[model samples]
Target: MAGGGGGGRSLEETPTWAVAVVCFVLVAISIVIEHIIHLIGKWLKSKNKSALYESLEKIKAELMLLGFISLLLTVGQSPISNICVSEKIGNSWHPCSKQKEEDAIKGEEIPDDSSEQHRRRLLMEAAGGSVRRMLAAGGEDKCAAKGKVPFVSADGIHQLHIFIFVLAVFHVLYCISTLALGRAKMRSWKSWENETKTAEYQFAHDPERFRFTRETSFGRRHLSFWTKNPVLLWIVCFFRQFVRSVPKVDYLTLRHGFIAAHLAPQSHQKFDFRNYIKRSLEEDFKVVVGISPPIWFLAVLFLLFNTHGWYSYLWLPFIPLIVILLVGTKLQVIITKMGLRISERGEVVKGVPVVQLGDHLFWFNRPRLILFLINFVLFQNAFQLAFFAWTWYEFGLKSCYHDHTEDIVIRITMGVLIQILCSYVTLPLYALVTQVIN
Candidate 1:
């Protein structure tokens, strides 16, 4: 895409091989890296101390969710590409207005020498109908060249190179540095054991720490409908088995104590970060971070290679972003409702269990910290939704983008709602569906 080949072609016109290959390669790389991580973990298990592995594992799940989001953005958005031609992967991604504005300034073919024309363009964009009116204005003006497509600097070679080089450097350095810590005497398994014991002792003395257990699931009211669907539970139970096959890859930050309490075996649950992070090296807690870089690399390749078929699914990567948003929002719901469930007897509460909680599933059991995370995820979700909504209004509905399907605001809105519903309600909805089928 960088040189002369893909410069003028639309996304639909491009071949799928480039993007598909990129995706494949990145995924392969991720698999390889994870294998290396596993080997390191295995080696640590032999070493008996594994202090370095413990440290890396502690940061793994945090890296997973955060890195996954970053990977999504990295691959889906042509961070390196100008806005006009930035489309790459993912289902829910959309070009931000700021990026588009920059692209317009850099890629604009029409001479903007006239002050009058520039002023008029600014006003139209601010008023929210920039495209249609601008096209109309371009029609009346001699310089507009009505039928000619606007020029764009579609070459993203520099952007891709810089991003890849910098990320690779950081990635290499970070990996090496963490591995180097393994050589030191401090981070060994013994050190981790001591830290875990200390943390456990502190948590036991703190009466407020009980909230970080499994009781923070969705309330009975939100899940009232799923109680009747036994078959749906069966399906989820079966699905869990398949997922558990690769449990090591499933670890992620979303499993704060609340999520963990519901996802792991209730009998042996622990709510300490210190314990869980080390356990993550041995289990499913590090999946997200392990896979993020490879996915991101593939996304970058999608852009750098100038892959075709970006518009094929109206941005498939965007869907995952929203799903991630839904999961985070659902957690906020749990935290908000968690307060109402506490009683005179203590942290006993009722809710739907998504999965069994892991020992040390939470980052920490401190009430203040938990409260802060809840607030943080809430504000973050709100900002993302706002941005998505704005982009939908500004660009999605506008006629300028390729294809009528993507341009249909009504359909896009409904699709988004449906996606959100599927994210949070799929298991229960499956149960409801199975009841009817049975």
Candidate 2:
């Protein structure tokens, strides 16, 4: 099949499913063959020129041949449309080429024939091959030309090809970010234990003892006590469950505010801006925006399961960027408010607003704004890339959008259902896993 021949055709016409099945079978066969060859190779290693060695050598070569064949087949099935086909020249072709060179001739006016179809396929294949070859050959001109190949209006498969290209580009970016950020460094199951231990340590060892000399009737009433110190209310209510189990301390009189304070000094050193930012990012990574990891993980599972289906897989690219933007905006608003407060204090010079870290007030001035803008732009770009990929894929699969309305509804509903399930599962699991793991 070439150009529009493959587009909008039935699954049977392309037999893509059959191709996939063949690939799977070949892989399985190759695995079995490799194992057999490995055993024979090992057995032959003990004897240099024995009969066993000769037999094993033949088997090894066969296995290698099969492996190479399997790899080529798999690559052919890949969305990357790169393959070379050479055309046979004829006397009529020379006259047609001369006419085409002197004056552009309309291709569609030519009668459809076996020879024409063959030529078209060869030209399309050559285009694909040249695009890839240009990439391999280093130069700015080559790369610029290669960039334009996916969008050639002459090719009927241009839409499908470009959609895949955009997806491949986003996938590469995703892999790079994931590697750099180490987002999955720890499993979510261990969160509770680490958080509990940290809470316990802070409750026991806070250095600042804000003494209240006025021991009045307000103290006796208990209402004046916790109400006067909302910080005390948060600790006694939330932080005390784990703290009570750790060391010898009275819950009512244990005046350590740093136990539950966000800005408390972490072990080994007093808290600083760098460490604060590090811990903040760490917590963010561990947390799923609305719920727990298992649920979000399940949502991811659903997306992956539907990835091969047309239109169904269209939304896959957009989700990551959406999540990032949502989370990042939430964080920015929080930091902006905090920065405002820090700026008001005027004690610590420089940084964002209300938050004070050690000797400096967090400044919400020009420099911080510039930095936030840069971060926001990066986050927005990632989201847009994902969104564009999904929309572009959708556009390619259906010229008549009305035809796929039902499919669209079904996919959206499934996505929502999975995301809701994840939201429900993640919170409790996060608490449980954190307790157990670290």
Candidate 3:
């Protein structure tokens, strides 16, 4: 695909429709490749009856479905662009014609396509036109004036902006909606966990305890026994966590939550992994809720600064502050855990002995391993944060023009990235550091 282009001449000279075409083609080609992969996997499954073939079949089915969605988006880009620019000149915008200095010097009037002419002149300058060519053009300034040079390389980018902004807005909405749904799901899981725990605890004391229990009546009315069977729920819970753990955070303890809860009982049948997953989801959901507000706040801050001039760079200190604070929360969690580990000197909490604290921490050997993990993570986060700061400085503070020269989506995307960096990367790192140092 063609590059998005940079500097004054990049976006300015490229025709608007040209960009849409390249993007559409790129998506189409990717879908075709994925479809081929899916077909091969299906063929392999038909020829082989191995476990690996079964997994490949599942993977192929998923890839084919995803390819269909990818194709839809690629095919939709042009219509979206056309819809955006339809009211204004009908999406027929083109680059300016190459301006001829000789014609201008001969008292000739510029044509309607003078913009296209001027871009050709600029392209020549970009191509390193010699002094003789420059001199023949009667100086670059006069040529530029004839071309009606734009501050933003206004060539074709102005029209493209509408479509880019539209997608950015869509992404923002998609993210927020998912977050809301996730939180709601967490609440449901927590409520279910509490009821399950109460029922199991009551039944644990007596074999026939659940026969006349309130939970039996409630469970029957809400869901059949088969629906909530320990085996089926375990499959769904483990699979959901596995899916989430792959691309999302909490890779380690998220899965271990179920294991820890399971192993606490002497036998596997004595503990339910489904209930454990419910408990884990309930807690993990809180972390997501806690991290989301500040990310959105920062995103909005970036959107505002997106339109601002270089004066906005004065607020650079704020970025590091955000990073530090994010790291600090993790530190707080680590520190509290560490303190609990050491406080087992027969100290009493409310009426419980401090020795019980270790039992409450996540997973086996966490007290020994977690502190080391936190420190290493902190160092890495500190390094990555500094690196991000340097790149941000180069991309924004040191760039071409100070005004709204770049697209809003670029800034919006950058802002969203920073939030990810802070929440997922740096914050966890520093939290570890803070836990150790404090």
TM-score of the candidate numbered 2?
0.25
lDDT of 1 by residue, 1-438 (tens): 222213345658868997689889999998998898788778877877555566457555544654665565455443332233212221123222433444444434224574544433332322211232233212331112342212221122323333433444333343343223322311332443343346563454243433422333333322333323655433333344223211211121122333334445331234443344334322321221133444545444433322223452354434444543333333333322332333222434323222222213223533223223322322222222333344343333441232355435433563444333322223122211112112
TM-scores vs. true structure, each candidate: 0.26, 0.25, 0.29
lDDT by residue for model 3 (262-297), tens: 355233234543344333333332233221334434
The best-first sequence of candidates by TM-score reads 3, 1, 2
RMSD to the true structure for each prediction, in A, is: 17.4, 20.7, 18.5
What tens-digit string does per-residue lDDT give for candidate 2 at 311-425?
Answer: 4335543443344333333332322233334334443332111122221211343223322332332323333354344543533223122135554554445434333322222
User: How displaced is residue 176 in candidate 1, in Å?
Assistant: 16
- Please list the residue runs of candidate 1 whose C-alpha ends up more than 4 Å from where it truly belongs after superposition: 1-156, 166-225, 230-274, 277-287, 291-314, 322-438
What lDDT does model 3 reach?
A: 0.35
Q: Candidates sorted by lDDT, descending order? A: 1, 3, 2
- How far residue 306's Cα lies from its native spot in candidate 2, in Å, is 27
